[model samples]
Target: MNKVFNTRYLVHLVLAGLFSFLVFNLTYAVRPSDYDLKEGDTTSASGSDDPDVYIINEHGYKRLFLNPVIFNFYGHLGGFAKVKAISPSTRDAFITSGLFRNCEANDEKVYGLESTGEDTSILHWINTTGAQAVIDDPNFFKKVFCINNNEFNWYLKGSDYNSVNQIPVYSRDTTSTSTVRVGIIEFVPQNVVYGDVHYAYLKKTSGCWLSSGGEIGNYYWVSGSNQSIHSSDCYDILETYSFLDIFNNLSKGISKNVQRTIYGEEDTMETLHSVYYIKDFYEKEALKYGVSDLAIDIDVKGPYMLASDPPLGGRWGVGEGVCNASLTEFFVNEAISRGVDESQYDVIAYVYLGDWQLSGRSYEGFTSCATGSKSFMTVTTWRLPQEDEGVVTLAHELGHSFGASDYYTSPCPQNPTLWSCVKDPEGIPEPNKIPKYPQTKGCLMAQIIAYNKPGSDEAGDATSISNLNQAVICDATAREFGWR
Candidate 1:
């Protein structure tokens, strides 16, 4: 009987120990600290006036706390508020507090607070303190915070913050053309950094512009057109000109037969014919829209020889195949020396020393604009043409001078897959910010060859002027040249 009692007692002791272990493990798993409050969870609050405060992550994910006391720092907030990322390394977490208030018409204060290490842990806090928040942090809190008071208002008007950094806030005066606005919000890194910043002016029932629901980065509340603050008025017509540079190799004799053979014609007046051909082409194309009376007076010069000390690429060296900026400059200087006025002409075409039949290649053309008002266009050819390709090439180069964009796809620094020759992704379009036409296959902007192959027998007929299929200038190009 004594042994049986001892065995029963030992078994009971073992059972009791197991029960205690299970209870401890279960309690730990459901502890208050272990519970993560995701977006949209309603919890009781301690300091929050609304008794409901939500957690907004860097990516703008919102969650309601299971226990409001966990995030006691968040309270009833009015005015503008946002969250942004503080550090680039930990973009997923470590958000900065972005809060601001417009107390009066001439007084405002911006506040920024950020967590150091972890999101829920809240290891350290960095706060923007003082009369006005300094634009000294790597976060968006400094960038977006502002007061609407006179002093703060003066700062917004005087400072060009958008020129240096990306700010998401737009003005409450929707009709106003100003680019900047005043507000304060937390720095939620991911929200502030990567995508397009959007903002909208809500027409409140009170007939006031309500700058509410402010965000750091892209938000659905902001409309696309509202995001664009400035657009230039493109209504002025450009006075354009064409300067032709005809190259004659000094080594070759200036015989009628040589000129005829080089120009692909039996006429002795090769230069005259070429000039007339270009003038007629421009007149026919430009007169259709009445953009400007096409004035292309051509001056053909140069039976000049290449310099012995060719700078680079052996260009203009006896018979070497080369084309570059240096060569283009050399040709431009030659044209000027031959009495072609620089101010008179906006476009230049250069025909150089090589046979199109033997080389069958043309150097691409470009435009340069120093004053930002008008483009100086230039095209260069290594050899004279024996086919319609010469006229096509010349027209293509002049197109650049006239603010026409190229449709061909080429690798660029901004976009590696493909980039337009005319439109820059970084800033507004040159000449005007007119929308570029959709790239059409085999169009004049896309290629130099005539699409319909009209006037196959005539020289200079492969251009847009003669070929109906190749003659279409996109609406954007038309607007850029003030044709529309």
Candidate 2:
């Protein structure tokens, strides 16, 4: 009887050991918490009384876990089943609050026997602590970091609790709108300078008109009686005949700077029909010279109204102003039809003071475009004989299209007494000191080139006209519009 009893006791002990091994393995396979259910979501489990406990936290997560009864009694019954719910915001708070730093903390063991490996032990610790954390604060177990309670308090206290670790947001009025915007247009001329208030020299400068070979040639008789309409054409003629010829004859000017055969040729067509075909080509060329990548097509509905009553106030006069306004409007309408939205383009009428007021100051060219209008428009004015001044006038007017400020100082009392605008120590600037307008010379607004002055230091420097400088002009314009 004693032998039989001892044998039965040994069998019972063996069975108990088997049960312990099975339960430990089963727990290892239990699913963890999910934290991705949305607010107001309900989840159901195999044996849960309430299926509405699942909720997603701010960070969006969900998890599954063994039900309490299954966690305890399932091992006794040799069954494995669990409940599931969305992780809550408390987990996020734990991480943000510095409760646990990394996976190492999550791997700690809390209630269960600690595993030998550090990672496994910590995971076990966190699994148990997570449940307790939820009990302490229903939303506390949202993140893995929150599984460790001691670390959270320690971080907050050490950081003074006032240090904001997250980005803050501010609100602005969202419904505000404006019906109208304002704009302005101005010009720069040849051979101007910019300086500081203390007369500390800032820069010597040249205007766009001067740099582009404008106002450098004699007037051409289109009809041998009619004057040339385009100012640039006249400048080109002078560049070809007067400057190039003289320079070429003296000291290899032809090879050194003129590039006569390659650079000095004009359009070969003598007939009006031929000229018309290439009109757009010429205009496009001019636009490129102005440093704009976006080209404007020439709309020559008719010849520039140079023959109108009272000579149409050539270039920037009041009559020219009216004409410019009309042209700008026409182009603006076309752009709008081609899918450009309102306010995308501004049109300004550039009017020189002499032209608008009929001051008979023909040499003092004038032009204006509508202020703040994205579409460019200008009625430029020049002398009665505009042929010789094409380059200067055209470049001056185009400068406004690129948003350059005027370097010319008006006698107005309210103007800023800034050093760069006017009053240079060297008696007005000659030659462009800075290549780009802003922070360089007086800007395109001053519209003056170095050669215009007698005996200027930079008088012979053609390097200013290099393609690099041209590129700068194009670059600056592109930058203003946030383009390449």
lDDT of 2 by residue, 1-484 (tens): 0000011212212322221100011101112233333432323432333232222234333221212331232233233332333222222111121123333365442221122222122122222234434432233334322223332222222111111111011011111211111122222222211110010111111331223232332122121111222233332332122221221122211111122122443212111111111222222222222211222222222111121112233344555433354544544454344444434222222222123223333344323332232323322222211111222233333344434334444441333332122323221322333442122221223433222222223334111211111111222322232222
Note each model's CA RMSD in angstroms. 30.3, 31.4
- As a whole number from 0 to 100, the lDDT of residue 56 in candidate 1 is 41
Candidate 1 TM-score to native: 0.28
* Candidate 2 Cα outliers beyond 4 Å, as residue runs: 1-293, 304-370, 374-392, 407-445, 451-484
Cα lDDT, all candidates = 0.29, 0.25
How many clashes in each candidate? 28, 74
Q: For residues 450-471, could you state the per-residue lDDT of candidate 1 as single tens digits?
A: 3222223334322222222233
Best by lDDT: 1
Error of 2 at 348 (Å): 7.4
In angstroms, give how far residue 470 of model 2 lies from its true place: 8.2
